[model samples]
Target: MPSVRRALISVSDKTGLIELAQGLTALNIPILATSGTARFLASQGIPFTEVSEYTGFPEILQGRVKTLHPYLHGGILAPRDAESEAELRKYGIAPIDLVVVNLYPFVETIAHPEVSLAEAIEQIDIGGVALLRAAAKNFASVTVLTDPADYAMVLQQLQDRGEVGEETRLRLAQKAFAYTAFYDIHIASYLHSQHAPGTFPDPLLLAFSQMQSLRYGENPHQRAALYRSPLPPAPAIVNARQLHGKELSFNNIFDLDAARALLQEFPERPTAVVIKHTNPCGVAQGETLCAAYCRARDTDPMSAFGGIVGVNRPVDLETAQEMGAMFLEAILAPDFTPEALHLLRKKRNLRLLTLPLEQQPTTSPWELRHISGGVLLQESDGPGVDPSSWRVVSARQPTAAEMEALLFAWKVVKHVKSNAIVLAHAGQTIGIGAGQMSRVDAVQIACMKAVLPTAGAVMASDAFFPFRDSIDRAAEAGVRAVIQPGGSRRDAEVIEAADAHGMAMVFTGRRHFKH
Candidate 1:
């Protein structure tokens, strides 16, 4: 049998500690505990030696100086080897073969609104980190327990193998490192925010929690995982726990996040957006939500197959019937009426998500993206473009009716994937081309996808066209007007092309790239 001799137990939370201590004692492992833990063990009729007794000194400095001694750390960290054993015997040190420790209640203390700054600062632990690092360093011979959920697994391993395995020790060590990193990030962010309120820091503090393991990435063979920001009171997409469905693919979660983010932009109005892949296929607004669904669906019925739909109003029976006739992978709305709920229940595979409508803050502090072993952070695009800020650089300006269509198309174009071209007539999207490699190619594709020939439609480009080729192509497709953020050196050439075709043009001086 592997020698199970010494164990160190220290904890802020007392739940299940006595029971675990009793189990360890029954197995002939000596439990060395701190002051409070020792008292609890004695009260429970479970025997344990005080940590101060083992270290040959009483705890000082208001019990904060107990576990910082070299004797405790050396026993936990010393490798099990002949040379080390000889040194340990010369110093009369007994190896700490097991360590059970949990950090102070920093998260819990800060969670309470009434906690003062002094109390919160005191909750930042010192001894717990030392104990964790020591135990992790000697993980080859010691089992370090941190989370309460690991109790059963450790007990089972001790019961089955008579000792913890090396593989399990390494895995636990990795978890310990991750845990410490997360804790340090929280502290650093809190202190930095308190010190610097408004100014942007050189490096941002971004933290994430694993949400799920996906079936695959964008393709079938690539591995993928989903992570959400560790903000208190989760956002809609992050808080939405999947109750039922096949495992979500990475692309599925991306589209879902896009749909939710856009809908959060408009909470008071009845609107509908149809998205395929990562681009908007159709979008419409109406007084009655069912009317909006009708207009949005008719925008591009052919491309709506297997797409995702998001609505800003409660779903009604009439709208549900229209949705049920078509094939859709998912639908999200503020709520669902009883009849609508009954109708949607027939489509067993369709994922229905209902979130209570709440107004989103108009500003965002930061946005983040994952890179290999690092991350990129920047500010998120907060509000929609205001047409009053636009400048008319073209010789001929857009009429009031065309200006309305241009602004409407501009908002929808922002959510479409890069290399985006959208054609709008009146208030509805007539054509959308996205994710192509060239601007002119996107224009041709979008015009070809138009339900009508686009004789009177206005086109919105997400970014400035590098050349005038895209404007010429749009003119050939019978586009009546054009709207793009004007920053290109060849802007005059593109404006001339629109003027040559007797079309109206406006420049918003704002770019909306969704890459």
Candidate 2:
């Protein structure tokens, strides 16, 4: 292949544009740019020929027709063979040895809170993606770069070898295809989302970008990698900034997700959740974050050890100092005061993350779980309870405070694993039993886990009781109220047991089995 003699450059994220242009110029490679890119190069005092000037055709249709001319593409896409050379020579086309073009930020454009369809459509680059694909197709002869992060390596290769190697070209070509494919997927998905509303198409196009690679999956022998959608699904931990700490491990991510999901349940209040093995062992909402943390931690101090903690409120010095008392694995909150960050950073291995709680979306994206042969896809169980929809099934109705505790417990149970039971009082979980095989066993475990008095606390079951035994056990354990989705064969018997104990019971008609 011919050495790189000329290069085309256009990029929406102009991160390394000037440096790349300078390097190319130093290598005596002339740069061809268009519109904003040309202006940017000129402003940076880098010599570049505008594509319109090179093609002898003025940019039309608001800069959309700049690089579509054969003058530009033919130079980049032509083969290195004699026939291609003859065609290039006949057309007086200078062979473009490199094409560095990142398409317009369609994903970023649509990410705007108020971005209109017209605005989003306008950001789509017709020529940019075409140029990337054309250069990638002729990777045997030309190099294609769709990421600015590749600029340093590409320039180093050019500077060292006077040209990019075929191997490197092949790698860049593969990346370029992936780059354009993800871009197109986002565009198509966005357009369809606007046109079709709630409907998912026959072939669902899910676009994901790697956030990071995990050390392992659930166990050290398993492999795992983390990827995220193009757009952050509001109140996302993926978008959170790690202020200080060790890298988030697979277990950390799982536990943090569980804690954050529960934290979102009490958005307006100062909420704290302690999660271990992807199950909330303690959760509480208080007037202050420190108080919430204390209440949550106090619920099951043993389980809180080395567990991930999540708080909906910004962490202050007091809270951080309080947290410093325990050997915690990680803590996630909206923000932390400088003093708090300083205090927390002392624990070198602790992971500290910041999330914006107010930005959580009311509706959620799909939840996907993989099995041996297929994926289980379902909507997230985040749309919370409507108290008015809850039917009081027992002889006694819940008081105002019990109703609050019952709703709070109900929210907490949704995040627990199947056969779950949570006992909460005054918006805090006193005990929790999750992933048990039997409802009665779950109730017994939950009662056993309670460090505080279970008396007058509300019990929340993810599903209806299979028998009256669980209800009777809850009553024996001093649970005054119960919240569960009633749809069992013996629901009437369970209600009768609650009535027998003068305990208030609510039927939600909606189950939260998370197995």
Candidate 3:
């Protein structure tokens, strides 16, 4: 590869522009820059030929037509072969060895709630994208850079080798393509969201940036990676900061997400949930963080072993000390006290992640699941059922204490898998049966799994009973009240069974099937 002789520099974000341009100039590499970039270079006392001057045509259309000329792109797109070199010389087009450009801030501009469509369109970036694509396409002869972070490395390489390596050029080309793709996706998403609200587009464009490569997927044999949406960071598992311990595994991320989702259901108080295989083994709310964690863990201590724990409140010293007693895989929390971090760091293998509690969205607008040949998209099942909308379908209405427990169980059952059954008393779960095939089996499993006494416990089911057998089973297990979305064909028989057992049954009129 020939040494870098000439470069084109234009960027909206001037993060490392000066240093890059200065380094190139020190190496006797001339620069061709747009009007705005030329002004910056002039201020820095760096010599550069303006793009219009190089092309011998004045910039038209409010500076938008400056770098769109053939002189610029012809140089960037020309190959180093004899025929291409002759054509470039015939047009007086010098070969551009480097193209450093970052597109306009379209993503940042549209993020403002008051940004107008015209304003967003103005920031769409035409010339910059074209320059990057042209250079990336001719990467065999040209080097392209879209990220400022690459400036120092590229400069170092140029200083050391007199030109960028082929491998580095290919990598930069890949990054440049990805940058343009991400930019286009954001623009299309914004326009579609504005013009075709509440409707899915024919061609769905999704963009994600890799956050990390996991050691393995669900099984050790499968490969996996973690990617996050291109939008601004939010308080979420993907945005969480890892404060301690080993790298998070694929299953650890799944269980942590489940734990976080369950904690979101009870944000009004300090709540804790223990998750295993993306299902809650235990969940509870208490006056203190420690109490909540202890209650949630004790709900099913056997299943809580090495499970992920999520807390709504910041982890305190007492809570961390309590957690130290168990061999937990990971812990997710809003924050952690300094003392707590010191104490928890003792468990060197436990993953600790923290996401702030402020401004967390109650539910995401959409959830996506991948299938064999297609993808499934739907609205998230959240914001929960309103207690005022619940109807008393049984002869008896739940008392105040029973209603509290029933509501708690209802909140928990929504997070459980389909055919889910949860038994609760006070503010803590007593037993939970999830992902069962039969509703009656879920009830029976809930009873059999109970470490705490099931007597006086209230029951909550993810969906209505298909028959009266589930109600009879719950009644026999000493459940005093039940909450479920009653839309079954056998609703009458189920209600009759609840009435016969003197159990207060409330119909939420909304089902939460988490399959």
Q: Write the per-residue lDDT of candidate 3 for residues 368-414, one digit (tens) a residue.
A: 89999999888778545589999998999899999999999999999
- Which predicted model would earn the best lDDT? 3
RMSD of 1: 3.9
Question: TM-score: which is higher, 1 or 2?
Answer: 2
lDDT for each of the candidates?
0.80, 0.89, 0.90
For 1-515, candidate 2 gives per-residue lDDT tens digits of: 45898999988889989899999999999999988899899899999999888999999977777789898899988888899899899988989999989888899899887999999999998999999999999999999998888999999988888989889999999999999999998888888889986665547677789989998888999999888877767777677788888888888887887777777777778889899998888899898999999999999999889999999888999999999999999998989999999999999998999888755554456677889986777777874578888899889989999999988999999998988999999988999999999999999999999999999899999998989999889999899999999999988899999999999999999999987
Off by over 4 Å in 2: 358-363
By lDDT, the candidates rank as: 3, 2, 1
Query: What is the alpha-carbon lDDT for the whole of candidate 3?
Result: 0.90
Candidate 1 lDDT tens digits, 338-419: 8988888787778787655455533446666899997777777764567788987777888888998887888888888889
Decide which is better by TM-score, 2 or 3: 3
TM-score of each: 0.83, 0.95, 0.96
Clashing pairs in 3: none
